[model samples]
Target: MTAPDPAGEAAAALGADRALRAAARHSAGRLTALSVSSVAAAGAALAEPALLGHTLDLLLRQDPAGARWTGWCAAVIAAEVLLDAATARLTGGVDARSTARLRRLGLGRLLRTAPHHAARHSPGELSARLTTHATAAGGVPAAAVSAAVALLPPLGGLVALFLVDVWTALAFLAGLPLLAILLRTFARASGASVSRYQEVQLAMAGRLVEVLAGARTIAAAGTAEREQARVLERLPELGAEGRRTWRIYGATMARTSALMPLLLYVVLGVGGIRLAAGALGVGGLLAAVRYAGLAAGVGAVTGRLAAVVRGRSAARRTAVLFGLPELAQGDARLPEDGPGTLELRGVRVVRAGTVLLHDIDLRVPGGTTAAVVGRSGSGKTTLAAVAGRLTACDGGRVLLDGVPLEDLSAEELRREVGHAFERPALFGEDVAAAIAFGGGPPPGAPAVRAAARAAGADDFVRRLPRGYGTALRDAPVSGGELQRLGLARAFCRAGRLLVLDDAMSSLDTLTAREVERALLRDVRPGTRLVIAHRVSSAARADLVVWLDAGRVRATGTHTELWRDPAYRAVFGDAADPDREAAGRARAEPSSRPDPGAVLPSVPEPPGREAVR
Candidate 1:
């Protein structure tokens, strides 16, 4: 037999303790009841074999009390059955309750964490952690209780054997060390394999989720087979780990299956010899044989240990989600009713050692619109994210209405700043609900309709089967229509600061222009930060902030920057020789504000170009 491993045993003990603590925290009463019932059931079961032996012996001797012994044996058997049933019921309840608590806690933490931080884990991995891992962790309490109960039969068997014949009991105990070594080996070996298997499983699941989300892109690229291969690339690793775990378990069971029965036969042989020598009576011999079987059935304990190891492995994954750091919030609240004057002071953001934005200092005055324009990768989106506090800057600060953004509570921030994304996650129950989903109180029907009209979305929405009451999933709205609904939702809440991150990308030129005009006319007067890709969008803004390579290249009205060749190149002109002539003709300096200029009426000169 192999020597005992103190380190392995210690780790197993620690894992069991952690599982127990989690269970106790979530389902203390249920766990306690389960443990109690399981113990009682095991105790009653342990007494049955001995009582049967005694009853049989009494019948053989033709004793008058043999009938009473038989009756007592029957009573013990019935009690064991009832106790076992209660144990099963309590065990399931405890597992379910603990699993639910873990899932809830994990999901809550995920939702509250910052988007960039939450992005560290993929959607598939997070889903698995909440589902598969949670279910496995929930079984920990039941396994612990079952493991405790499994000890009783063997202990009782050993005592009964010793009382019947000392040599038989000694023979039974001689094989126990081998069983212990086998269990420890399997527990240690299978743990690593199981952990690896779960990781690979999540990797594949994450890949699948990404593929499904981008199915249209894959189809357009005509790479369905290639994508399928990419998704299954980790399948071999997963299978290898799964096979390794099963092999270890099977080997342990095989060795135990061989050794435990041998130990039982040895005890039986010893009891038979003692009986022949008249050192033990027939009833005692019978009792010794039954006790030997119970003592050597160590397979039950092996199964329980396997369950414990599985639970511990799953708990580690769940812990990662639960332990994620939630975005911090302050105790202060925004002051009552002020224009949203946004200021960014020396803001910098670095992700994975790549600078997304650097030394950004800008201010958007209340009631004015500022368009952030840049080529793809030029930090426009990052700036919008920082301005909205969707992600906190690595350095410096952003303030709204003279209060640092970090000083405001979550509720205050949400109530004061609103965002509309290019691809909005519209997951409300119905069309109207989707249009009034975030930040502020739900708007009444008139307000919802007005916001939709402002976004140029009312015509299409009213054509849906149930109009406002149509389920969002069943509405089958186009991408542009969906973006409009998201815009309406953002407008309905109408925070002090509104950020549009390419929110109008899907709309046609006419629809976008109408929506922009309506935004200027109908929305509450507040600060606007628009991340623009088109020259038309920049032309509509009161001021334009031009970003190049994570730094602010220039800031002024669009007409002023239009003369710079590089700035014109942002709208895809290499060098416009006539730009200087155009600037001289306008005779408008970049510094002066053109208060009378309304964007839609601004004439685009021939060869000067418009946003394509």
Candidate 2:
């Protein structure tokens, strides 16, 4: 979900061939209508000069053709006006619909991708893709159709001039190569400029979004100016690229403006000579002059080309989101009575040529809690993610209840595996709604309330202004409360395997213990994987997995592992006195052995003390 290679994007937009083809597929009908109308209008416009010339001839000769030709000219003008109106309506509709479709598609892809892949994209970048890029690219169909139709007027005028006088047509044709060269140069320069402008704009926008999201931090640190400077670091590049685009546009227009009149004047002079030499009539001369003007006017085509260039640049950015690869899923279903046993075989995760998890082989029995403990960057979270199937490992086979996690259908996987994160995205109409946001048959009111209670969120919910009806956006809750609400949401889904990745990090000891008890008692029996940073959480778990530097260093009951100096050091425990104090704090009135208690020695495995 990261931004695509700049070179690849440039290739995609260089000719805008791919974007044009996509636009045609999505809005071909509207584009075709616009093109047909443009052609009709151009034809009507081409007839104007010839008809007026004929009228002038009739007036000079005192013939009746004048009235009829004048009336025909008025009809053609009326038809041209109507066609233009239709073209405008169609263009507006195409632009709106295509932009909407692009936004919807981009968001859908972002949501459906793996969490790790999605993290590679920033909110600001995605927002730019959904809005600015989509809107700009939406104009591609109109610009392409207009550019195609623009050629008709000049070509038709040249034909009419040739029929009237060969010398004038030849004179108009002679100046075309210069205009072509100018347009080609403008396109190449403007395309590169527009592409760079969009890139810089995206960078600035992304930085701004991040700053806005962290406004409280910046204000607390009193670094408003510093943050602002950082956010605007790319402003100069954006401005330079923007100005370059305009400069190219202006230069193209200036050259066309200077050349157009000279071309027309030369053709007119040739037409006058033909008339004076008895090779052409006065009416023929008039028609030739008008045709020369039409043939030389390159303004409309230039505008359409500019639009095409901008639209292509934007479309390339939008296309990156559309082309992101989706995680693969299968259609197999889990057995109804399957135990939620989790296993990882030869699990390896390599990112940017660095191993995050190496040859991880671990398993958790169904109906037990396994706490994965490690220092920072020790791959505990990665293990939790892989176990829950949130992300697939590079070289591994993960089986949930004897079924390969990847072999399960998406719906089945989501329904069978649940996850609670450290910081959850809880956006809903109200508190109750936020806690019930997940798959599986929608939780009933009773189920929602029960889940909230199980996660220790009920007391805070009742204190809110509207209780469960209070809007999440309006409620001013603390970090612990927010974490509990996220936990409640996860609890609502009756998944067979639940992964809590530092989900209760913000909770106090008593509250976390209560939630843990509630989870064990209320929820259906299932496997639980807890990524823990606290020694107390590991002490409460059925088994502890100690990971060091992307490899599992030890696995056993917390009581068994506590004897190791390395294991004690994971919790920053060193001296015997500090260990005793921590043990006293964790030792509550429970049947389980106290942290400091000397329990009877159990048989320890020979190699690395693995209990699995």
Candidate 3:
């Protein structure tokens, strides 16, 4: 159901006043043409009553030549056709622009959120927001404009009827209160159902996506029947909702359809008798009845319009996806300094009042490697995430190049601080493009191949038919291969902090070792937070952080921490013996390094495995 006089607000709201104001302003010409055509069509309808009355009076008086009446009739038909054709073309243009604006807004907003925000939403739902919802929005302008124009025929004819016989016009006015009540009730009830239906539609679509994605798994488990039943289970509710809507509409129309025809007769009959009795003129009687018919026609036309109203109501429910109050646009400029310093001071992360990490203070000197090793649920990944700024922490700050992470613009942080997730997302792009992903600039063949080789992905890529040009996309790719692709892409930029959040988790031992060595030896010389599970990867780290239960249990050089029982248990015999043995052998106590000042953990850029 639409708001009373919603056409006024709909047109006004859809009019300029957004980023698309320029585009909407440009579209004004086409919209004006559309309005012109609609007016012409309404004019044709209004002219019919006058033409019919004129032709009848002329023939009855025996005053018209046949050609004159015939010509007038032909002109009316031609005007109708021209109006219909022009209206369609102009309205179609408006629909195109409206849909385009909605789509652009949705995509533009998504572009503003954090890098991983898009990954968090279901792809199918995201697609529906842009496509299904957008498609529905297109019809709103057309139907709403049509509805607005529909009002013109009735109102214009009523004006003519009022002049002809004010008595008959009163009869038409008698049904006003009823029609208003009917349409108003329909708009509200149907609008609510429409919003609910769209929510269900999104839920069903998400289910479909899951079913499609896990088709292989479902089939392997012999659970296709079960999954299909799950989808079917929701269908009954949807079917019920559809059937319920149809019933309400069918009932409403049953009453109004009968009421409109009856109302038409009361006006026409009363006016006809008055004309026959010389109380009203013949021309007045004909025009007034015709106007009365046109007034009743609003009921028949708007009855069907209820469906379009419901459909748009469904679309607007999802308007927040794009029609948000604010669009996302980062204003922060890129930090001028390189990835010179990374520090997390007194940082803690909590979820639902349960502390996940506590009082973690850490630092990375520029161009050094530190391996964070801990058991599962030990906050290894969470700590790495803090440096990557993936999740916000409750207390503390993560800084890059001495600037707080939050203050740095998203663009600067991304360009200067590159991170690859363990389960990295490679969008629907080619293998080379995926590898060169967030890498600084568009890469050439030689650069792509060299980076892939360094990440140990070149040999496999060359085996494909198109080599660097081969499309990996979403068709299918091994986990290990995807990991390497993320790795190779990391080499595309330099002078950045490289955070490997279990980056090498999927790779085999030898491949993982090789990739880490390639990164340290040849990739960017930024500080690295190498989150790892295996002890061997930590062996080469200039500094080792042993995490346990979300706290920094120990932080020292690999050799210095070997003899610490807590560190030994997590890293085992892998810690360096010579340095730990001497530290244990030293009778003198050791003092902790200053958090603000140190050699900056800058080791010969020796690194280890990425986060697991």
Candidate 4:
């Protein structure tokens, strides 16, 4: 195995730090308030012991001024309590705002990245990063401020000790080295454990998400128990890590708990000696002991430091999303009324050192349909993706209407190009909203119905309880119905170019043919790049581009390619029966029309004209 790159690791750590700083800055105002309040609270806490001791001394001497000192002591205590409350409030605000900022940044990057790049992270992993990891990262600003402010009480108490009695102060100073050693050790060990714990949590979360997505499959296969075992494969590791973190924390607190009282007692003993020598008063000795206790309260500091360490580790995980390379959009726009002519020059795509598509050159003129036919893994989907700039070509360039895809602004590119996937995701409030969802202003109700009709989705949609207004979650659509909605969505925004990547695979042949007919006659006319598996789809296209392996093997009319047995074998047994009939007709040349001829049209589905 190759050795790890130390330089790359260091750079990633640095990037994580920078991401954390940016998140902190997003809530700078509230963090500043939290810091100020924390410092003020620490100051008040430090002053309390001295004020109470003075009041006690005055009361013992029968001084009338003792009442005033007690009142002042109460006021100081009240101020400390109020300041701490304010700090808590400020910390909440900072955390909320910072978390929101981190989530927005991460989500924006996820959405802006090319689809293939974004798929590098699993849905569960992405969800964990944006939710739990973002929450932890967001708390960093408050934690850092509080940790810094936590130093004030200890340092002030040390100074206050000296002012009370030099001997007591020196006694407290003697134990400072031990406290420093404890904090350093806790920080180092706790950080490693926390990081390991978070990593395990992320792994489990990713597995759980995978299981959820495949729950139905697992249930059907009667592998629920097996899948559950797989999902929780790391549960023991997670538990171990959790125990390790707590053990470190418990160990550090136990050490601090043991050391603090010893130091306090040493100061107390020294104060007693001073009192015996007439060098310290009872009130002064009392103050000295309190100061020493305050100075040795390293446990509070350790807890705060632990928060900082955990936040830093979580920040690293959350920062990964921000590192995704976004698909950059240029400032240029397409020419007005330009035909959706698409041209690919030496287009190539590679992932994990394996070529998915390579050296592909093709052009489809505006107002035509081109079907990409290939066996499994033949680069058809990749070609469809490249056509609409869903994924950038690694080797060459793709142009739409003479403008390089990379040169078009995001708004311009999305507005001019559309896509429907085999399993398209429907996103919106209801059925109508989902159909109308696309770049630019949403299509109005009439346009939505027309598009739905063209995709043969109107009849079923109208049969629903609330028709177009039905909630998506409430509309129990099948796979084919879902595909129709996706096609409808694409049709509603059909522009200069539309890419359908096996978008009709789930539909029955009758519905698929009807949708195809409407696509040609009723939908907005544009260039269509269809990634097809069924022979009928290829036959209906104006042109067919056959892919073999990662290269374009042939480009012609489906009829022309049909004469080649190798080309016919691509569809295998799944070839349409009509295509078989056409093939038989071709074999008996004198009996029937050419096999390449368009199949006879079927009657339009009923109620198709109502939507029109």
Candidate closest to the true structure, highest lDDT: 4
Give every collision pair in model 4: none
TM-score for each predicted model, relative to the true structure: 0.88, 0.90, 0.82, 0.93
Question: What is the per-residue lDDT of model 1 for residues 430-455, given as tens digits with 9 covering 90 to 100?
Answer: 99988888764667988888889888
Better of 3 and 4 by lDDT: 4
Alpha carbon lDDT at 167, candidate 4: 88
Clashes of each: 0, 0, 5, 0
lDDT of 3: 0.71
Query: lDDT per model, in order?
Result: 0.81, 0.81, 0.71, 0.85
Candidate 1 — which pairs collide? none
Provide the lowest-lDDT 10-residue window in model 1.
603-612
RMSD of each: 6.5, 5.4, 6.2, 4.7
At residue 321, what lDDT does model 4 achieve?
88
Q: What is the Cα root-mean-square deviation between model 2 and the actual structure?
A: 5.4
* lDDT at position 332, candidate 2: 93
Give stretches of model 1 more than 4 Å off: 1-20, 61-64, 573-612
Instruction: Give the CA lDDT, 0 to 100, for residue 602 in model 2.
Output: 19
lDDT of 1: 0.81
